[model samples]
Target: MKHNALAIALTLLLSALLGLALWWDYRRNATPHPTPGPASFPIDTRSAARPAPAPTQALPHNGLYRCDGPAGTSYQSHPCTPGSRQGDVSGGTLSTVTVPPPRPLPPPVASVETPTPKVGLIARGPRPGEGNEALCAMHERDIKRIDEAARRGQSSESQEWLREQRRWHKDEMWRLACGR
Candidate 1:
């Protein structure tokens, strides 16, 4: 009986020592110095700094289409118009001829001369009085001369004369119409 009591006391003492040692180890590990703050973990800031790529806009008829048939045959369709099939009907090999895509047209060149305004075959505006009739007649004659010069390809002389006639007519018409 005495031997059993001594053995139990030694066992209890050993268990208490083991428990105290385990508690000390846990406390040492749990209580941290220079406690964790915001920048504790090594964060890869580059990933956050990198901008996400812009989403691609899909054009018309861009997705894949599929078709199935008898005899355990299945086929994928391409971007084609209605009733146009990429594969053969009889399961034969298809001959593909890839046409070179059309090149974009260059932008139109800007011309120095203004385009003539076309208002069908009708008198442009109200006719001037008898006193200004000669000015009107002169304006018409100048226009005819300009047209003839342009038709004959006398561009420089025609442009110069046309500019002079335009300025003269504009000034005269404004004066006659407004009684200035």
Candidate 2:
């Protein structure tokens, strides 16, 4: 009987300890918490409600204008009228104006000189009617001789004859012979 009573006492102590542990765990997890819902923040509404300021206007259109003032002269849209006296506020000086008159250009001078003709040596073989039959025949014979000399590698003789032939067949000679 003593053994059975000791067993019952042990069982009751274990049950009480388990119940205390459960109660402590429940209390630790039960503190008041924030509700699980959506959150919001404040926003500034003045920037959205106010409209933007207007842009500045451009200067007036008059004509080409130039300014000469005491505070570093510069160009501007509206120039002061001629003979108008204006005082500079910053420099404290009165402005003086001078109007320029439109001058007439001199009449284009008429030319009296005649243009001279350009003259140069001709390079082609022989101009038509450059010489009388005998002279032309002589020229043809000289050219043939020069060609024969060139073929034989006598370049100096060929070149000399070519110069002579060119001189003989000048434009004036051709014109005279051709009656042009």
Candidate 3:
């Protein structure tokens, strides 16, 4: 009764305050920020971008090692075993390999056959043709059969039939309007 009304009022007031806070936050973020000062820019970004080179350690070394064991063949950075052959890895880092820039595509070929425009005022819809009245009556009978088939649980077939009906309706309207 009265308590319910008071609870609803408090809830509405809380909602309004929350909405006001969101509006204030949106406005604060939406306002354009001042541009950074020149002093804020990094002095030597190129040097900073380059990573420190890895330290070299002395060891029994071979650039690449390939081992042909009784099980199978394997290749790694370790020194080759007594029975296996050693070889260098091609392209140092395979991931860093670059592709040549792509050639520019040729312009589209123009269409040779251009249709000539019809002369005088154009008809708003399909032009009237002979025997269209009989065709429209046949379409109406087909539509009634389709509706019955739809009631028998053939939904997909009925939907396709309905599309055909709409097409026929358009043709019928055009035929009746132009008296053909």
Q: What is the lDDT of residue 152 in candidate 3?
A: 76
Stretch of 10 with least lDDT, candidate 3: 53-62
TM-score (all chains, Cα) for each model: 0.22, 0.20, 0.21
Give the per-residue lDDT of model 2 (tens digit) for 1-98.
99999999999999999999999999989986777666856766877688543223322433334444455455444544443322222313345468
The sequence of per-residue lDDT tens digits that candidate 3 reaches over residues 37-81 is 455655686787885432233233344444455556776666656
Off by over 4 Å in 3: 36-180
RMSD values, in order shown: 30.4, 30.1, 25.1
User: TM-score rank, highest first?
Assistant: 1, 3, 2
Comparison by lDDT, 1 against 3, better one = 3
lDDT of 3 at 122: 50
Q: Indicate the TM-score of model 1.
A: 0.22
Candidate 3 lDDT (Cα, 0 to 1): 0.64
Off by over 4 Å in 1: 1-130, 155-158, 178-180
Of 1 and 3, the candidate ranking higher by TM-score: 1
lDDT, candidate 1, at 77 = 41
Clashing pairs in 2: none
